[model samples]
Target chain A: MTFEKWMRESLDRVETALEHFLPGTDIAPAKLHDAMRYAALGGGKRVRPLLCHAAGELTGASAHAVETASAALEMIHVYSLVHDDMPAMDDDALRRGKPTVHVQYDEATALLVGDALQSQAFIALTTAGNGLNDAQQAALVRELALASGSIGMAGGQAIDLESVGRKLSRPELETMHRKKTGALLRASVRMGALAGATPDAAALKALDDYSAAVGLAFQVVDDILDVIADSATLGKTAGKDAKDDKPTYVSIIGLDASRELAAQLSRDAHAALEPFGARAQRLAELADLVVNRVH
Target chain B: MTFEKWMRESLDRVETALEHFLPGTDIAPAKLHDAMRYAALGGGKRVRPLLCHAAGELTGASAHAVETASAALEMIHVYSLVHDDMPAMDDDALRRGKPTVHVQYDEATALLVGDALQSQAFIALTTAGNGLNDAQQAALVRELALASGSIGMAGGQAIDLESVGRKLSRPELETMHRKKTGALLRASVRMGALAGATPDAAALKALDDYSAAVGLAFQVVDDILDVIADSATLGKTAGKDAKDDKPTYVSIIGLDASRELAAQLSRDAHAALEPFGARAQRLAELADLVVNRVH
Candidate 1:
């Protein structure tokens, strides 16, 4: 299949799996469940889950395990976005081309929604009936928790907020990206591998290396797009990062150099998958797609 | 031993165990570790952990398993308190007789601290040396996630916030309390049993019944203390719940009726423990302590 077709298929599978896993109670507080669905189903590329599936496939992991892991990762991504768009955070009015959760609902609702999503991610991983033994399931839960919490996404966000308007060196920027984005991405691969129970030490290390390069490349491309893409195309304010004076790869390394770095990182990411041979084509394509996409 | 003496001894053991579990880590941005420890060690009654220990003992679960389960439960409790104290949540300036986390640090720091505490809780459980198989570990993680997330404590808080100033029926109050305070308390017992690898369905149900009754009784006493205790003695703002116009057992039912209800629930809790015979004295004492405490 073409890359776009493959991506869409994978995302559709993820969404269906996620929806299936949600709490299906007929309780009076239907609104909470509604809010969760709204935030999760709101359109965006299922990059994290796709990455999980791709990495799993490359390592001979089962599709069912990959789907569950992908759904969990996507839930975390959705929760973060909902929280990030709150008035106290980015205060963005739009996300994924529509009103953000807080704008669509009240701040309290949005906050609760985010909290629920965060918790639900773990619940999904814990409850997934993929025939995983307790130890492997516990490992997946640990990976998700570490990836989504402080010293990971939350820590990275704190640094990002603190570093706003300040110039950061390459090492500092990389550190921020590693926590904010790389941690979850790396966990996605690790979770998929764990779910499949195929993540031997060497495979795990290679996936981590692949995840780090792709994660950084993902951020660099994002920064480059903020400069090159328009608000209409990006679905949110494009140049808001620059307007807020947040440091970016394009700012530190110039647009051309940033592009070069992203390309090099993409190549590194693909090379990290060398052991998987032909099974890694999709992941390689995903790396290329990360750097080359417009939004 | 008298209830107070037993509690004091149990608390001491829990504190010592906590310190041993949370050995100093060298993860940089050392503040990450500091924030985590600050929140975790910044004292509370350790009621949840004690419950886990008591339940574990009743089930003949290992002390090591009990300690791990207790530590994880305490971490979740601490994380909830930290997040709930944020300006956007309860806006509290004091907790456990000390400056609330956000007040001592910055809001961002407190947020990250809470996030880290939560992540560390699951990490602790997953990495626990309890010798349980993977399935048991997964069950523990799942239980914690359910108790802490939406449809649990966070959801309870949201509902409580919305219900403030509004009169609620008895069932409504029960539902709120079940989610807000009871879920984790029940989970504490459940986790203890799971950690013990004692999968006796009947005993689990009995403990659940015991936990539910004791959990409500605990809230009743808390509500009563809000009315009768002073801030200094309670180590928190006294009568804040009533001041906020929040519904409570004492508020909805007269004080006399509330006390009667608490007594009845305490009796029910003890009756539920009858199934475990003499092995459950600690848990029975805990239920008594819940209702009899002055603060």
Candidate 2:
């Protein structure tokens, strides 16, 4: 299938799976449920889900398994965004061109919403009859938990909080972004691979290398877009990183260098997937998409 | 062994397990890790862990498995306390006789601390070589996730938030508490059972019944203590429910009736374990302790 067609079909499957798994607004605690759906559904480019599904393609993972895993990944990504946008965190109001959970609802509800989404994501992973065996389910849950916890995404956020107004070296900035955003992105690919048959160690390493490059490239492109793209185009408050005085690739290495670095990383991502050849076409396409997307 | 001795030994084991599972404070993002340890390690009654270990005794669950599960349960309980005490939530400043996470750290850090602890809890469950097979691990993860998510503890919290000033009926109050605190408390018992050999359906049902009674009794006693105890005695802001105008068993049914109800629930809890005969001795002791504790 063409990349765009494949992307459209995968995004549709992810949306349906998320809707099926998430509690309805009509349920008890309706407001919290409403906020969860509002935050998760109809938002962002679903990049993580795309990555998960693309990676799943390389292993011939069942579409049902991939869909559920994709939903879980998207939920985790959305939960992070929800928490990040809270008044206590980034204090942003706009996300995906819409009001953030805290702004749309109350702060207390948003907090609960984020917490609930995190739980729901695990629920999606551990839900029975999702086509994954017990070992796969357990491994996937562990992978997600490790990526989401203190040493990973949340730890990165803590570092980000401390790094504000500090002139971080390129290494420090990379470390922060790698943990903050890169960890979950990496987990997305790894989880997709695990959801199917176990690949050879070399193939696993290749996917890891591919994911690492794509993950970093995704962040580099994000930094580039934060500088040059309008808030309208980005669907969030553009230039807030500079305003917040946080370190970024653009700040550390200049815009041109950051762009060059993203290109290099993108090439590296594609190169890492060469072992799988045609089987990794979707992953290669996703690498290009992550590097080249405006938002 | 005497209940007190068993309890003390169990508490020590849980502490050791929690310390082992938690990230070291000296690690990078030291502040977040430090706060996580601070919130989770010292203090609190460790009621959930006690219940888990007590339940584990019934099915001869391995000490290692029960210890890890206890830690996971305590982590979830502590995470709820951290979030519940946040300014955006209950706005409390105290927990376990110390400043709440938000007070000791910042709101953002506290939020992340709670979030990270939750992830860490799942990590404890999914960690390999913890004496559980893959199916057991997956089952346990699902139980934890369901209890923690929107339809469980978080859902209960949302209801509590909405019903702050409103007078809820007894059933309504039960529904809220069941989800809020009851879900995780109940999950603790269920997890301990699952961590070991699978109990027969009848035994599982009995355990469920016992957990339901104990869970409600625990909350009823909490409400009673909030009314009758002081902050110093309770290790938290006592009477805050009344101060916040949130309806509780005491406010709705009167303190005397609430006490009677707790006693009855305690009796019901003990009765539920009658099927297990003397094997449920620890659970029986725990039921009494929960109903009779001062704090």
Candidate 3:
């Protein structure tokens, strides 16, 4: 199948699983339920889910396990977006071409939605991992928890909040993104691979390298798009990061250097995946898709 | 040893475990880390941890497993307080005789602190539960997630938020508390029991009944205390629920009836523990502790 066709099919599967996992709008706390669905259900590129499925292909993980893990990863991603767009955070009014959760609902609902979405994500992790044994399933939960917890995504966010408008050395900025974004991205691959079969340490490390590079590349491209693309194209307010005085690759490094860095990371990702040869074609394509968006 | 002594010792043990688990203030994102430790390390009666230890005694579960699970439960409880105290929620400024997290730091820090504390709780669950096998460990996570997620604690909070200024029937209010406070309280017993060993279906059901009754009684006493106690005694803003127009047992059924209900619930809790004999003596004491506070 063409990459587009595969992506469309994968996105549909993710949406269906997410809908199945989230509480219904008519539930007792109707407003909160509505906000959870609003934050998760409708839109976005499903990039993290796609990455998960692609990596799952390497271990020949069962489709059921891949799909559920994908949904859980996407749930975490969406929850972060909802929280990030809150008035105290980025204060963005739009996401994926629609009103953000806090804007559409109230701030309290938005906060609760993000909080509930996170809990639901962990629940999803427990729901399925089709071929995994009990031990491996426990490992999956542990991996996701570590990635999302204080030293991972939330901690990275704390650093981001504290560092606003301050000059951060390149190493410091990279360290922040590695924990904030890199940890979850790496886990998606690890979870997918573990769902079917555990890889040796060396192979696991390679997958980690591949994921790390792709994750960083995706962020670098995002920074590029935020500056070059309009709000209509980005589906979010363009240049908001710079406007808010948040450091970005484009600002810390020049636009030319940022673009070069994204390309270098894409190359690194492909180099890490080289051992898998034909098995890694989709991963390579994803790296290209993440980096070549500007072209 | 006496139940009171055991309770005090257990509280101390829980405090130590929490101190070990929470990130240090010297960590890079110092403010967020400090807030998490502040919210969790000190204050409160450690009621949930006490319940966990008491139930763990039934199966003779390892102290290690019970302590870790107890700490995780307390973390979840504390995170809820931190978030609930936010301006968008309860608008409280004091908790446990100190400024609330939002009051001490700022709203954004409070928000991140809550979010990070929750993630840390799940991480704590994964770290230990020493006696539990992989499958059982997975179950521990699932139980905690179900209790903390939407349709659980967060869901109950949403109901509380939306129902402010709105009168709810007794049954409606009971349902809310069952999810709000009751779910986690019940989970505390269940987790403590699960940690040491698994009980048969009948014993498990009895423990559930015991926990449910005790949990309800605890909340009933809280409502009474809100009206009768001073802020210094409660270590929180007293009577805020009524001032905010929120429904409570006292408001709906009158103070006299609320007292009667608490007593009846305490009796039910004792009855549920009859099968455990001396093994359940501490649990019976806990139920007494919860309701007797009202008197």
- Models 1 onward score TM values of 0.95, 0.99, 0.97
Point out where model 1 deviates above 4 Å. B1-9, B20-26, B128-131
Kindly list the per-residue Cα lDDT of model 2 for residues B1-295, writing each as its tens digit: 8888998899999999999999997787899999999999989999999989998999999999999889999999899999999989999998999999999989999999999999999899999898788998999899999999999999999999999898799999999999999999989999999989888899989998999999999999999999999999999998898889989998999999999999999999999999999989999999999999999
- Deviation (Å) of B291 in candidate 3: 0.8
Writing each residue's lDDT as its tens digit, candidate 1 over A82-165 gives 878876677789888988988887776777777777778778778857645566678888798878777788778877877887
The weakest ten consecutive residues by lDDT in model 1 chain B span B20-29
Q: Pick the candidate with the highest DockQ.
A: 2
Best by TM-score: 2
Clashes of each: 3, 0, 1
Scanning candidate 3 chain B in windows of ten residues, the lowest lDDT window is B127-136
For each candidate, the DockQ is 0.61, 0.91, 0.74
By TM-score, the better pick of 1 and 2 is 2
lDDT measured at residue B16 in model 1 versus the true structure, 0 to 100: 67
Worst 10 residues of 1 chain A by lDDT: A21-30
* Each prediction's whole-model lDDT (CA): 0.82, 0.92, 0.86
**lDDT measured at residue A138 in model 2 versus the true structure, 0 to 100:** 91
Candidate 3 is graded, for docking, as medium
